[model samples]
Target: MFKLTLMPQNLEVHLPANSSLTELEFELHGQESISFGCRSGACGACVIEVMSGAEALGARAPCERNFLASLGFDGEQFRLACQCRLAGNAVVSAVAAPR
Candidate 1:
């Protein structure tokens, strides 16, 4: 399982391998100020900043790349939480971008 740690609040959420980032976000819902929309990775509303353990998440998908491009998010540190699949273990922080 992977661990998602929210910064400042220090909240932690565990996600199993093969678990989608959308599922993890749901699991962590209501715990913090995180928000999600268009769970299919087209809205880019669930973008997050990988604080550490990026290796735990699966590689970026084509849809995710397109969405990020549409949102003008070119930084390598950003990821769409809905499109990422847990591969191992990771600690992530919510970016709280506009929907």
Candidate 2:
């Protein structure tokens, strides 16, 4: 099992290694507000900052990479939550919605 820590709110969700971010988000839906649009990584709505265990998440998909590049984000710090699969324990900080 993998422990996902959502920061700012500090909500933690335990999930299987095979679980997708979409599934995790849905599971925690009412507990917290997470910004997300395309579950396929085509949108940048689900980006998060990895606070710990960065190596535990899956690789960035092509769409995520493109979006990240467009935003000039550091590859090591940002991850598209929708594109990342849980592998082990991870602590991530949620990004606030645009004003």
Candidate 3:
């Protein structure tokens, strides 16, 4: 399993390896620490910062890369939660940029 720590609020959620954020909608969405929109890469509302263990989230796909770039977010740490999955443990902070 992996531990995903949502920052500022410091909430911790556990997931088995290779889990997607979309799979956690029920466990997460209502939390004020983060926000989700569309649950797809098109909207930037799911933007999150990998506060630690960034490699755990792996790489971004072409569309996600493009969209994040368009939103002025660059680097591996910033990810669209909807577009990412957890491979290992990760700590993230919601930095939502709603569409």
Question: What are the TM-scores, per candidate, against the unseen true structure?
Answer: 0.81, 0.85, 0.87
How many steric overlaps are in each model, in order? 0, 0, 0
Off by over 4 Å in 3: none
User: What CA root-mean-square deviation does each model show from the true structure?
Assistant: 2.3, 2.1, 2.1
Give all candidates' CA lDDT scores: 0.73, 0.78, 0.81
Q: Best lDDT goes to which candidate? A: 3
Error of 3 at 72 (Å): 1.1
Give the range of the ten consecutive residues with the poorest summed lDDT in model 2: 90-99
- Candidate 2 lDDT, tens digit per residue, 1-99? 889888888888898887887776567866774577887776678878899988888777666777877866646778888878889998998666422
Worst 10 residues of 1 by lDDT: 24-33
User: lDDT by residue for model 3 over 1-97, one digit each (tens)?
Assistant: 8998988888888888888876666777566756677887887888988889888887888888888888888777789998777998888998855
Ranking by TM-score: 3, 2, 1
Candidate that beats the other on TM-score, 2 or 3, i.e. the better one: 3
RMSD of 1: 2.3
Candidate 1 segments whose C-alpha is farther than 4 A from its true place: none
User: On residues 1-99, what C-alpha lDDT tens digit does candidate 1 reach at each position?
Assistant: 667676767877787778886675468656663567887776767888887878777778776776776787766778888777778767777776643
Which scores better on TM-score, 1 or 2? 2
Cα deviation at 94, candidate 2, in Å, is 1.6
